[model samples]
Target: MRFSDFALGLGVAVFGIAVLLHVRTFPEIPGMQYGPAFFPGLIGAAFLICGVALVVGSVVRGAALTERFAERPAWFGDRLAVWRAVGVVLSVVAYALVSPVLGFLLTVALLTAGLLLLMGVRWVVVVPLMVLLPLFLHYGFAQGLRVPLPRGPLELLLF
Candidate 1:
């Protein structure tokens, strides 16, 4: 846990520096109260602050935290969970790469299907979930939030 805290602290410090760099370059846009970089800059600052706190807390409670984890069964130490997590991360990367080409509807639906399958959901349930989720998201964002969705060939065929 000490190592985890150290890594998180280091990562957040690096991320904060990266965001600060972009915010420095972000040009001011008129009429809006905040520029494009405002929210991300805020988040990066928050992350840096929280990371420092975590590192300090970890140092204070180091021995106790190590004892707690040591009490857990050896079976819980299986590192395969990390590989499984990597697959989920890769799935998101795949979605980003394909979203523009496949468009929002198809890309989101495929992502839902892939995630459900990865989680061991059967095809019978996965199919309906994959189809309905993207439609639900479309309604939630496009209709409710008044956000326009990217339309590709699917729009031409469906609507």
Candidate 2:
């Protein structure tokens, strides 16, 4: 469930570098100083900086750098862990099977609430998340990214 700081930092640094390099291929906009790559490139740069900081900090802290790359998670021995894992997998499968028909908003709302309850989150938390999280995702994917999410009767009423 976890990796040593050195290992984790190395992976993050490599991922950050990859992102930065990949974003370099995005074509510039003719009239704009900031193109399609602007935000993503900034994010990649931030990642690179953070990753380097993590690596340096870990090294400076005198952590043996020999910490186990991975340790058996405590949950592995717990009986309910299997049910929890199964619940998560079932949620994903259910989402894939029903998302188009239910629409992104409804499907995500249901999935969020179900998973939260499965993980023993209280109703006070789950209720608001069920509503707000779906709307946030809809805005991010549908409005911000301009991706076309399937529309159901509820979406027709709302959007």
Candidate 3:
């Protein structure tokens, strides 16, 4: 738990620094209004505060925390779960990289396909989901949130 606290604290510190750098790039708004950096800065500060609280709480309660977050053994017993987490992280990274080039819908479709395939889902089920998830996400994000996503190579085919 102490080690977790140390790691989280370090991560939060680094994230806060990153947010600060981003904030510096934006021009200040007039009339005390919020600027582009407002939300990200707020989120970064929240992360920093939560991290500090976790470290402090861990210090106060460390002796009493006998069971690690879950009851499973540390190493080999949880290897599969750890690998799944790693796969998810990699998938997200892949989506981020591909989204600009392949477009949001295609990237999301690929992400869904990869995840479903890795989870042992059948191709019949996986293929439909791969096609549907991206369409759903595109509508949800673009129509619902009013945020536009890149169309990339599929723009002509889609629109």
Q: What's the best-to-worst order under TM-score?
A: 2, 3, 1
* Residues 25-122, model 2: lDDT tens digits: 99999999999899988888888887888778788987636577667788888877867898899998998899889988889898899889988999
The lDDT values for all models are: 0.75, 0.86, 0.75
Candidate 3 residue 102 Cα shift, in angstroms, is: 1.0
Backbone clash count, each prediction separately: 0, 0, 0
For candidate 1, write residues 1-159 as lDDT tens digits: 234665566677778777877787887788887998898888878877877776676678774245332244453476655555766899889877887788888888888897787777899999999999988988899779988787667755875
lDDT of 2 at 117: 90
Candidate 1 backbone collisions, by pair: none
Look at candidate 2 and tell me the lDDT of residue 154.
73
Alpha-carbon runs more than 4 Å astray in model 1? 1-80
Q: Look at candidate 2 and give me any clashing residue pairs.
A: none
lDDT of 2: 0.86
Q: Write the per-residue lDDT of candidate 3 for residues 18-133, one digit (tens) a residue.
A: 78677878887887678888888888787778777766666677632542443444644677667767779999899778888998887888888888877768999999898888
Selected candidate, larger lDDT, 2 vs 3: 2
Which ten residues in a row are the worst by lDDT in model 1?
64-73
What is candidate 1's TM-score against the reference?
Answer: 0.52
**Which 10-residue window of candidate 3 scores lowest in summed lDDT?**
63-72
lDDT ranking from best candidate downward: 2, 1, 3
